[model samples]
Target: MTNPKISLILSAYNEEKFIKKAIESVINQTLKDIEIIIVNDGSTDDTLNIINSYGNSDSRIKVINQENIGLGASRNKGMKIASGEYITFLDGDDWFATDAFEISYKEAKSKNTDITMYQMINYDDESGRVYENDWFNLNNLDESFDNIVFSPEKTKNFLFDLSVSSCQKIYRNSFLKSINASFPEGIYFEDMPFFFHVYLKAKRISIIRKHLYYRRKHDASITHVVDANYLDTVEAGCELMRRFIDNGFYEDYKFDLIAYKINGPRMALMDIREDAKKPLFKLIKEDYEKIKKTKYYQDYLDNLGPKKKKFFLDILKYDNYTEFKKNNPEY
Candidate 1:
């Protein structure tokens, strides 16, 4: 009945296939003083039934069912009701290493930090192979982000680049609540903005280099499937950049970071259907125009070097890149 030390929030939507394994991973955690709150986001499949079975068996498991809200909204809902000192997220389709909670909890407590981030093992569902060793390790910097400044001169450089996935991190509930930080509702790239906001605000953060979170790469996941929702995520990234500019942090460093963020979604847009391409391109063009007006525009253009600069120039010459792709065939 007492508040738990950690809360594992799972935002599920039609994830019946992997819910059991995800739950079992938490149940088998080496750390025991934890509660698992499963937010069943109006899953039409057996996801809720599977979660109910676990709730019946384990006193630590709790379930909340609501109409279909996106992942961000579900997480926000869970955070509002979470009764733990520390919190972490687990997607329904992904499973955690058995010691994830044990390792992160102890490290956060010992270090007395606002956040503790662990590395991840990305699993390829098709080949049944492990692609990489550790995904979140950056080359330079300490485990904590206590002294990272957001000013133009300081922000332009890669002070920190390894904050990748949301599930790979454990956060102090008090810090999260103090910043009034929750995943932004109704967005596709929910993790990036949320992670950026938290990392920028953190007085202290810890990074565990060992790979503990297992991310299952499936075709059905939003990251794999391209859609209008995905374009919305790209727009959200632009919005974040605009926020940085509004706060007087726009510089060559910040612009490069925004460009880097935009680049992934742009590549993903290539794999989307032909019909979705035009509107997405228009949105990207609008974002690009906004970037061009910033003081860092020339620096961003110069820093793009040869390859990306050529691509951007080509897109500008053609009005859009899809037309060029159509003409070139080999592109």
Candidate 2:
């Protein structure tokens, strides 16, 4: 009846093709003191049967069957049901390196940190080519953050640079509940706001330089999809802005917020559906217009290089997708 060292929450919605390997990865972890909580988010395929089969065979595996909620809500359900020292997430479409828990748990225990961040291995389904997730790339970072446990306030410089993906970090169970950390339900970028809220409040955060998880980027996953759901990014941005202002961290991370506001939508623009551009652009415009009146607006823009400066200029110029295409054409 002793609690496990880690609770690995697997969220799935018709991910039958990859669920088996995902389950096996946890069942075969180098660290055996772990509990596997599988949340079947109303999967119409054989996902439920496969999950039940694994649950029946393994005493440590716990399965929850529910109507389709969302990635955020499913994780919330798992967090409440989990009884472990620490909690981490694994998408049913992804698998972990066998030693993932062994390494991260050791770090979390030794450092006594609220959260331990690590790297992810992104593999293409068709090409079978593997590459490190860019979030942990040192060249992109201003400093080395390996094997260190530090407070969030002292390390505010790299706040926005970190990935919001929940799977990249292992969180102490009590610490997470203390802050009431929960992802925003029914949204695509649910992790964005949740990450900022808890990270800003965390007393201790640790970083690991090695790739500990494997993330599959197949066509069915959200990353490759081009649809209306991309509009959820706008709502996520708005929610994070509110959290920043209300939580008293707005002044400290104003530029970081601005930078993400400008760059985040631009990055998504390249992949969002053609018809979805105008509304997204309008929301971006409204957000940026308020930024224009701020005294530090020029200071933030002055620091940007030539290409980014031009990109912002184009963004500020047009409120409509047709006008943007007429002027820039290149995008």
Candidate 3:
């Protein structure tokens, strides 16, 4: 049998409410040469049954039933069995635009790139409002060319900018296999590190300035939940930073690395659980202190704007973020 043009891997864990719509989106894609690989990570709800219902109707729908192994492992499992020339990810709770695969695949082929990055629509479940993901707005670089290949330095900056989400991007199957890029199993925030590895190894990357995916946000989503699991961000950040230094890209990418470290804790302080906040903040603070001693971070701080410098000062001042916020309400 001939391989499909694109393989869409959907990782689900009790996402029964949105699984049907997610499946239908792939099945109805404008590009018919696609396969939908749904990994039911031991869903206790009717998610598996829903997947079965669709698998029966569409020959392209492949379902894998396995024990609850979390998103990272489930995605790895799907990738191992994928038979498509290009690969992409879609959360079971989210769906894609009908022409998503068609457009991305065409761009990847025409550009002969190892990866193709695109924008997404962030849909708020409660508010019923849709907005473009901020990553696109923040990237001031021009992307009007038919094929603008990212330079090596730009690739490092892209990874550091936290534009490392696995979704809303299409990757060449050969490039992924060659690099052996896979997510960290049994961990939260797995995309960041994997994204760094992929972009660093990729020789050619293309960007599209259009929204082709929908990222649904709600209270139940992992991103919105406030818990100890959020500490995984610190763990991932530290590990990736050390790896960057060890790999000898630290000298060139240190500015970005330091910026990432500083911004991470600032964002974490905003949403982490009240009880776990202080401990996580301490860890982030200690890591920052160590990173700041490096020449790269010191240089970055030398040129930092007054507003940002003040922000960093406040963040590093108190170990207890709760008390800090109370004392300085502006933060």
Q: What is the TM-score of each predicted model, taking all chains together?
A: 0.83, 0.88, 0.84
> 224-285, model 2: which lDDT tens digit per residue?
78767777776788788778877888888876686676566776676778888887878767
Name the candidate, 2 or 3, with the larger lDDT value: 2
**Candidate 3 at 322: error in angstroms?**
9.0
**What's the CA error at residue 271 for candidate 1, in Å?**
4.2
The lDDT of model 2 is 0.84
Runs of candidate 2 with Cα error greater than 4 angstroms are 136-144, 282-319
- In model 1, which runs have C-alpha deviations exceeding 4 angstroms? 137-156, 226-229, 246-252, 271-273, 289-331
What tens digits encode model 3's per-residue C-alpha lDDT throughout 46-105?
Answer: 999999999999999899999999999999999998899999999989988999999999
Q: CA lDDT, every prediction?
A: 0.75, 0.84, 0.80
Clashing pairs in 2: none
Residue 200 alpha-carbon offset, candidate 3, angstroms: 1.9
For model 1, residues 140-160, the per-residue Cα lDDT tens digits are 444343333222123225633
Lowest lDDT 10-residue stretch of candidate 1: 147-156
C-alpha RMSD of each candidate structure in angstroms? 4.0, 3.1, 3.5
